[model samples]
Target: MSVVITQVFNGFSLGSILLFVAIGLAVTFGLMGVINMAHGELIMVGAYMTYVVQQIFAKYAPQSMGYYFFIAIPVAFFVSALLGWGLEKILIRHLYHRPLDSLLATWGVSLILQQIARTIFGAPNVAVLPPEWLDGGVRIAGVVFPYKRLFILVFVILSIFALYIYLTKTPAGRRIRAVTLNRDMASCLGISTRKVDAYAFAIGSGFAGLAGCALTLLGPIGPTIGTYYIVDAFMVVILGGVGKLIGTVLGAFGIGLVSTLMEYSTSATMAKVMMFALIIAFLQWKPSGLVSVKTRSLD
Candidate 1:
C-alpha cells in the first residue's frame, strides 16, 4: 500500500515536470505550427535567470534570500519571453509556412544558445539553493510528500488555470485562437496575425521559463540542462495532440504514471523503450493523436 502511494506521488511529480517542459511546445508547435527545436534553450535561459537572481539576492540582500524566488520567477519569464519575441521577429516569423526550415533554423539557434551558455557559465553544472520554506516534507498516509514537489504540482495547476482563463476570456487570446483555427479568416476579420503570432510565441516561451524556474528545485542546472527534458517534452506534446490543453494534461500524467510503474518493474532503459513502442503503436492507430483539433478547410 505504501509503495503504491509513493509511486503515485512520484508519477504525478514526474508528470508535472514533463507538463512544464511541454506546455510551451503546445503553443509554439501545436498552435502556431512552428517546429522550435530551440525551445529547450529557452528553458535553459530561464534556469540561468533563476541562478542569476539567486546570486544577486545572495550578494546584495543576504538577509532576504528567502524572497529571491519570488523575484526570480518573473525575471525568468520576461527574459525568456523577450528572447522569444526577438527570435520570432528576426527568424521564425519568416519560416512559419515552412516547417522543415523552421526546424533546421531553430536547431541552429539552439546550438548557438548552448554555446553561448557554455562560454558564459562554463561547462559545469550549478546548483540553485531551494528556499528555506521548502526544505522539508510532510508525512501523509505513511508517505512523505516533499514540499518542493508539492509546490511544483500546485504551481503547474495554477499556471494552467491562469492560461486557460487567458485563452478563453481575454480578447487577445480570442484573437490568437482565431488565427490558430483559420489564419486567412482571422486576417480577413481584421486581426493582426503577425502581432498575434509574436505574442502567442512569447507567451509560450514564457511558460518554458516558468518550467525552468520549477526545475531548479529538482537538481543542479547547466547549459545542457534543457537537453535533458527536450525529448520528454516533445513526446508529451505529440502524444497529447497539438493545441489541446486537456489532451496535454492527460498525456503528461499518463506518460508520467506509466513510466514510473514501468521503471519500478523493469530497467529505466527498457521502460523508455516500452513507452516509445506503445506510443508508436498508439500513433499508428490514431495518427492525429489523443485529441484532434477541429478546423474547417477548403476541399
Candidate 2:
C-alpha cells in the first residue's frame, strides 16, 4: 500500500510537469490554431534562462543564491514571452490561416534555436543545483514525498487558478475567449483579434518557460531538453480537448497516473506505445476530443 501510494504521488508530480508544459501549448493552439513547432525550444530557453540566472547569482551575488530561483521564474517568463511576442509580430502574424507555412516556419525556428543554444551554451548538458528549500522531502504514512515535486504541484494549481480568473473574469481574457470562439465575430465586436493572438501566444510561451524553470529542480538542463517532452505535451492536449482548462487538468492527471501504473508492469517504451494505441482507439471513437470548445460552426 505504501509503495502504491508513493507511485501515485510520483505520477501526480509527473503530471504537474506535463500540465505546466502543456497549458501554454494548449491555449496557443486552441485559440490561434497554430501548430507552434518551436514551443519546446521555448521551454529549453526557459531552462537555460534559469541556468543562466543561477550562474549569474553564483558569481556576482553569492549571498542571494538561495532565493535566485524565485527571481528567475519571472525572468524566464518575460524573456520567453518577449521572444514569442516578437515571433508573432514578425513571422506568425503573417502566416495566420496558413497552417502549413506556420508549421514549417516554426520548425525552422526550433532548429535555429537549438543551434543558437549550442553555440552560446555549448553542446553539453548543464546542471543547476536546487536551493536548500527543495533538497528534502516530507514523510507521511511511511511514504516520502519530495519537496520539489510538491512545489511544482502547488505551482501548477496556482497557475491554473490564475488563468481561470483571467479568462473568466478579466476583459483581456474575455477578448481572448471571444477570439477563440469566433475570430470573425470577435473582430466584428471591436475586439482586436490580432492583438489577442499576440497576447495569447505570449502567455502560452511564458507558461512553457515557467515550466522549464520548475523543471531544473528535477534534472539536468540541455539544449534539446524541451524537445524531449513536446510529444507528451501534444498528447496531453489532444486528449484533454482543446481550449478547455478543466479537461486539461483532468486529462493530464489521468494520463500521468495511468502511464505510471503501466510502467509498474511493463517496460517504459511499451507503456508509451500502449498509451498511444489507447489514445488512437479513443480518438477513433470520438474525434472531437475529451471536451471540445463550443463555437459557431463554419458552413
Candidate 3:
C-alpha cells in the first residue's frame, strides 16, 4: 500500500510537470490555431534566463541566493513574453490565417534559437542548484515525497487558478476569449483581434518560460531541453481538446498517471509505445478530443 501510494504521488508529480509545460501551449495552439514549432525554444530561453539569474545572484548576492528562484520566475516570464510579442508583431501577425507558413517560419526560428543558445552557452548541459530549503524530502506513512516535486504541483495549481481568474474575470481576458470564439464577430464588435492575438501569444510564451524555470529543479538543462518536451506538450493539448482548459488539465494528469504506471510495470520504451498506441486508438474514437470546444462559425 505504501509503494502504491508513493507511485501515485510520483505520477501526480509527473503530471504536474506536463501540465506546466503544456498549459502555455494550449493557449497558443488551441486559441490561436498556430502550430508554433518554436514554442520549445521559448522554454529554452526561459531556462537560460533562470540560469543567468542564478549566476547573477551567486556573483553579486550570494547570501540571498536561496531566494533567487522567486526573482527568476518573473524575469523568465517577461523575457520570453517580450520575445513572443516581438515574434508576433514581426512575423506571426502576417501569417494569422496561414497555418502552413506559420509552421515553416516557426521551425526556422526554432533552429535559429537553438543555434544561438549553443553559441552563447556552449553545447554542454548546465545545472542549476536548487535552494537549500528544497534539498530534501519529507516522509509520511513510510512514503517519501520530495519537496521539489511538491513545489511543482503547487505551482501548477496556482498557475491554473490564476489563469482561470484572468480568463473569467478580467476584461482583457474576455476580449481574448471573444476573439478566439469568433474572430470576425469580435472584430465587428470593435475588439482589436490583432492586439488580442499578440497579448494571448505573449501570455502563452510567458507561461512556457515559467515551465522552464520549474524544470531547473529536475535536472541539467541544455540548448535542446525544450525539444525533449515539445512533442509531449503538443500531445497533451491535442488529447485534451483545443481551446479547452479543463480538458488540458485532465489530459495532462491522465497521461502522466498512465505513463508512470506503464513504466513501472514494463520498460520505458514499451510504455511510450503503448501510450502512443492508446492515444491513437482513443483519437480514432473521439476525433475532437476529450472535451470539444464550441466556437461560433460565420458559415
Candidate 4:
C-alpha cells in the first residue's frame, strides 16, 4: 500500500508536468486547429534557458541558488513567449485553417530549432541540479515523497487554477474563448481574431517552457528531450477534449495514474504500448474526447 501511494505521488508529478505541457497544445490546437509540432521545441528552449540561467547564477551568485528557480520561472515564460510570438508572426500565422500544412511547417521549424540547439548547447545532455532546499523528501505516514516532485505538483495545480480563473473571469480571456468558439462570429462582434491567436500561441508556448523547467527537476535535458514529451502531451490533449482546461487536468491525472500502474506491472515499453492501446479504445468510445466543448455558430 505504501508502494502504491508512493507510485501514485510519482504519477501525479509526471501528470502535472504533462498537464502543463499539454495545456498549451490543447489551447492552440483546440482553438485554432493549428498543429504545432514545434511546441515541444519551444519547451526545449525553456530547458536550455533554465540551463543558461543556472550557469550564470552558479558563476556569479552561487549563494542564491534558491532564488534562481524563482527567477527562471519568469525568464522561461518570457523567452518562450517571445519565441512563440516570433513563430506566430513568421509561420503559424500563415498556416492557420490548414492543420496539415501547419503540422508540416511546425515540424520543419522544430527540426531547425533542434539543430540550432545542438549547435549552441551541443548534443550532450545537460543536468539541472535542484537547489539544496529542494534536495530532500518529505515523509507522510511513512511514505516519502521528494520535495522537488511535490513542488512541481503544487506549481502545476496553481498554474492550472490560475489559468482557469483567467479563462473564466477575465474580459480578454472571454474574447479569446469567443474567438475560439467561432472566429467568424467573433470578428462580426468586433473581436480581433488575429490578436487572440497571437495571445493563445504566446500563452501556450509559455506553458510549454514552464513544463520544460519542471521536467529538468526529474532528469537531464537535451535538444531532443522535448520529443519525449510531445507524444504524451498529444495523448493528453486527445484524451481530454481540445480547448477544455478541465478535461486536460482529468486526462493528465487519468493517463498518469494508469501509466504508472502499468509500468509497475510490466516493462516500460509494454506499459507504453498498453497505454496507447487503451487510448485508442477510449477514443473509439468517445470519438470527440472525454469532454467535448460546446460552441455556437454566429450565423
Candidate 5:
C-alpha cells in the first residue's frame, strides 16, 4: 500500500513536468498552428541554464545551494523566453500557415540547439543536487512521499492556476484566446496577433524552462534530456486537446496515473509501450482529441 502511494506521488510529479511542457505546445499549436519541434530544445536550454547557475553558485556562493534553484528559476524563464521570442521573430513568424514547413524548420532548429549544447556543455551528464530541504522524504499516512515530488506537484498546480486566471481574467489573455479562435478577426479588432503569438510563445517556452529546472531535482542534466520528455509532452497535449488548458491538466493526470500503474506491473519499456497503445486507442475514440476547439472562419 505504501509503495502504491509512493508511486502515485511519483506519477503526479512526472505528470506535472509533462503538463508544463505540453501546455506550452498546446498553446503554440492551438493558437498558431505551428508544430514546434524545437519545443523540447527550449527545455534543454532551461536545464543548461540551471547547470550554469549551479556552476556560478559553486564558484561564488558555495554556501547558497538552497537559493540557487530559486535564482535559476527566473533565469531559466527569461533565457528560454528570449530564445522563443527570437525564434518567433525570425523563423516561426514566416511559417504561420504552413504547418509542415514549420515542423521541418523547427526540427532543424532543434538539431542545431542540441548540437550547440553538446559543443558547449559536452556530452557528459551533469548532476543537479537538490536542496537539503527538498532532498528527503515525508511520511504521510504510513506512506513516504519524496519532498521533491511533492513540491513539483504543488508547483505545477499553482502554475496552471496562474495561467488559467491570466487567460480568463486578463485582457491580454482574452485577446490571445480571440486570436486563437480567429486570427483575421482578432487582427481586424485591432488586436496585434503577432504580438499575442510572441507573448504566448514566450510564456509557453518559459514553462518548459521551469520544467527543466524541476527535472534537475530528480536526476542529472544532459544535452539531449529534452528528447525524453518531448514525446510524452506531445501525448499530453494531444490527449488533452489543443488550445484547452483544462484538457492538458486532465490528460496529464490521466496518462500519469495509467503509466504509473503499468510501471508497477511491468518493466519501464513495456509500460511505455502499453501507455502509447492506450493513447492510440483513446485517440481513435475521439479523433479530434479529448477536447474540441471551436474554430470560426473569418470569411
Candidate 6:
C-alpha cells in the first residue's frame, strides 16, 4: 500500500513535468498547426542553458551557487525564446500552409540541434545540482516526497496561472489567439499576423525552456532527453484536445499516472506499447480527443 501511495505521488509529479513540456507543444501546434519536431531540442537547449548557468556560478560566484536556478529561469526562457523566434522567422514562416513540409523541416532542425549539442557538450549525460533549499524530502504517513518534485509541482501550478493570464488577458496573447482562430479576420481587424506568429512561437518555446529547467531537478539530462518525452508530450496534447488548456492538463496527468503505474507491473517498453495501444483504441471512438477545440474552420 505504501508503495502504491508512493507511486501515485510520483505519477502526479511525472505527469506535471510532462504537462510543462506538452503545454508548449499544444500552444504552438494549436496556433500554427505546425508540427514542430524540433520542439524537444528547445527543451534540451533550456536544460543546457541551466547547466551553463551552473558552471558560470560555480566558477565566479561559488558563494551564490544556490541562487543559480532563480537566475536560470529567465535566462533559459529568453534564450530559448530567441531561438524559437528565429526559427519562425527564418524557417517556419515559409511553411505555414504546408504541414508536411513543416514537419520535415523541423525534423531536420531537430537533427541539426542534436549534432550541435554533441559537438559542444559531448555524448554523455550532464546534470544540474539542486539548490540547498531543494535538497530535502518530506515524509508523511510513510510516504516520502522529494522537495524538488514538490517544487516542480508548485511550478506547474504557477506556470498554468501565468500562461492562462498570458493567453486570455494579455494583448499580445489575444493577438496571437485571434490570428490563430481566424487569420484573415484578425488581419482585417489590424492584427499583424506575422508578428503574432513570432510571439506565439516564442511563448511556446519559452514553456519548453521552463520545462527543461524543471527537468534538471529530476535527473541527469542529455541531448536526447527531450526526445524521450517528446512523443509522450505529443500524446498528452493529442489526447487532451488541441488548444484546450484544461483538457491538456487533465490529459497529461491521466497519461502520467497510468504510464507510471503500468511500468511498475510491466516492462517499460511494454508499458509504452500498451499505453499507445490504449490511446489508439480511444482515438478510434473520438478522433477529436477528450475535448474539442473550435476554430473558424471547425465552426
Residue range 45-162, candidate 4, lDDT tens digits = 9888888899899999998877788888888878998899889988899987788898999999999999999999999999988777889898998998889888898988887887
Q: Of the candidates numbered 1 and 2, which has the greater TM-score value?
A: 1
Scored by lDDT, model 4 comes in at 0.86
Instruction: Mark the 10 consecutive residues where model 6 has the least summed lDDT.
Output: 290-299
Candidate no. 1 TM-score: 0.97
User: lDDT, candidate 1, residue 131?
Assistant: 94
The CA lDDT at 145 in model 1 is: 96
In angstroms, give how far residue 298 of model 6 lies from its true place: 10
* Model 1 C-alpha lDDT per residue in residues 1-299, reported as the tens digit of each score: 99999999999999999998888888888788889999999999999999999999999999999999999999999999999999999999999899899989999999999999999999999999999999999998889999999999998888888878888999998998999988999999999999999999999999999999999999999998888888888899889987898888888999999999999999999999999999999889988788987767668
Residue-by-residue lDDT tens digits, candidate 3, 258-285: 9999999999999999999999999999
Candidate 1 residues lying further than 4 Å off, grouped into runs, are: 294-299
- Over 1-299, each residue of candidate 5 has an lDDT whose tens digit, in order, gives 77877788778876887887776676777555678899898988988899899889989999887799899989988899899999998999899889899989999999999999999989899888777889788788998777888888887888788878988999988988899877899999999988999988887788778878778887998989888888888889889887788888989988888888899889999999999999999899997777886768558
Cα lDDT listed for each candidate: 0.92, 0.88, 0.92, 0.86, 0.85, 0.89
RMSD of 2: 1.7
Better of 2 and 5 by lDDT: 2
- Cα RMSD of all models vs. native, in order, equals 1.4, 1.7, 1.5, 1.6, 2.0, 1.8
RMSD of 5: 2.0
Q: What is the total number of backbone clashes in candidate 4?
A: 0
Q: Which order, best to worst by lDDT?
A: 3, 1, 6, 2, 4, 5
lDDT (tens digit, per residue) of candidate 2 on 1-299: 99999889978987998888888787878556788989999999989999999999999999988999998899989999998998899899999889999999999999999999999999999999988888889999999998999999999889878888888999999999889878999999999988999998998898888888988989998999888988888888888887788878877887889888888889899988998998889889977778876767777
TM-score of 3: 0.97
Alpha-carbon runs more than 4 Å astray in model 3: 294-299
Error of 2 at 177 (Å): 0.7
